[model samples]
Target: MAVNYPNGKKFLAESHMPKTTKKKDLIYSNRGMTLEEEINSSNEHYLSSGRAVIHKKPTPIQVVKVDYPKRSAAVIREAYYRQSSTTDYNGVYKGHYLDFEAKETKNKTSIPLSNFHEHQILHMKRCILQHGITFVLIRFSFFNRVFLLNSSYLIDFWEDTMNNGRKSIPLAFIEEKGIDVAYGFNPRLDYLDAVDKLLEHTNK
Candidate 1:
């Protein structure tokens, strides 16, 4: 399939091909860094620096078909999008379990509430009830601004949307209720800083 970039550059980006690595180890690269890549790299940095234990949740996928020629590489012919059963990333941080969903949007004013799934929201609510830290890392690509919005604010508006007629969470509301995560060289989103603040509030 051909994809067109925002600048009208058309090209075809092939899907992942099956390959064997020594010991079946996962490889990390910044060559095509998506938001997911940045978060994973940041988590690695944190783990190495004794900062926190956070990791991206691996979603299990079922391969429907594959084609392999003799003495050649294998290609995935078909696959199904797996349902994510948990938050995007989760682990213990400073004695508290932290759960988060990282998302990006091109919209300049607000993030569409539809970007969040019902199951994902319920998972976060459960975490909050269990005294775990729960929040979302929302990146506004247009502005390069990231905010850590707690689950409480999200669910509040989410439920309200059912009858209140708001389809998206306005930027003003996010600015008022969410903690701004400063982007840095290390933890690209630096969401841990906001986590620290959440921890302080809970401890007080």
Candidate 2:
């Protein structure tokens, strides 16, 4: 059984691939969880503690073919994405519509704006227009720092790039504009604390 993209390219799962290592790419840290894994842990804690209701958005896939090798098992032979996904996650928080994207960068100086897409920035803008709380959780993997940046800043930088402005968001600018999220035990990344501060200022 095989899965494919809409463009007729065969899709391979990362878990099924052979692992390779690069000495330059290695980071010395006791906390080895990826940004997405940490967020998932936080979401679970939030859900169980009645703090928030957020979940990762599943990509829509359309299965074109399947094979029943056994009476109890069916394997998908072909599939394609139904459409481009909007964001990484979305749900309700503190009686407000929450929509956000989580990204991790190993760069020590700046996070490249290319980490974001035009459609995603537009989607965040649309969410804001609906009076929803939309933002990005940026993890600077090199420094082990996390920042919760509001969507407006992300949208502005994206537009600036269209005019041949800076290609990356400076760490200094992020430290100034975005709220820092401290790492913790139970939830791992305490991003909701940053969101609470944002709500305190904007109340939107």
Candidate 3:
């Protein structure tokens, strides 16, 4: 008599099983840290230093299946997102509501508008209507440059796209409209310095 498995393959000993690296683990090990990781670290630093109270919005996931190999351990085998998530980060800064989306692009010449979803743009617009400060932190990974772009500018281009305009925002336009955020040692991205400038301009 032979033992069988779910997929009609014989069960192998633990030592004979091939080792596999998770996609996120491979990304971290091979490409340093992702943009989200860097921003989360920066947010933690800001919170500890009393600079801001920002947090990453957790995406709700629906777990479909759980495998209980042992009574003490259970692993999720299947899951899906419950719904589309809003911006990456949101919180209160100096009594002002702050909301922002973070994105990275490898394209050297342009950042495509398609990278943004319709719901995200609408969320930013709604935030603005409520007098909340909204912006986007975009990184041009290839050039090792990061920028803080006001949501107003992003919305302008997004609306233009609806009118059948250009499909992407050129790097030149971004350089002109966006503020360059300095990469630093402590907070890492140092985007709040750029935010200060935006606040000053708005107040004036």
Error of 1 at 138 (Å): 0.5
The segments of candidate 3 whose C-alpha lies over 4 angstroms from its true place after superposition are 1-31, 65-77
Per-candidate alpha-carbon RMSD to the true structure: 8.9, 7.2, 7.9
Clashing pairs in 2: none
Q: Candidate 2's residue-wise lDDT over 88-179, tens digit each?
A: 89999979899999999989988999999888988898888899999999999988999999989988888999999989998999999999
> lDDT of candidate 1 vs native?
0.78
**Per-residue CA lDDT of candidate 3, range 100-194, in tens?**
99999999998999889998999998999999999999899998888899999889999999999898888899899899999776687789899
C-alpha TM-score for every candidate: 0.76, 0.82, 0.80
Q: lDDT values of the candidates?
A: 0.78, 0.83, 0.83
RMSD to native, candidate 3: 7.9
- Tens-digit lDDT track for model 1 on 113-138? 99899999899888888988888888
Which 10 consecutive positions of candidate 3 have the poorest summed lDDT?
Answer: 16-25
Q: What TM-score does structure 2 among the candidates reach?
A: 0.82
**Which structure is stronger by lDDT: 1 or 2?**
2
Candidate 2 overall lDDT versus native: 0.83
Off by over 4 Å in 2: 1-30, 81-83
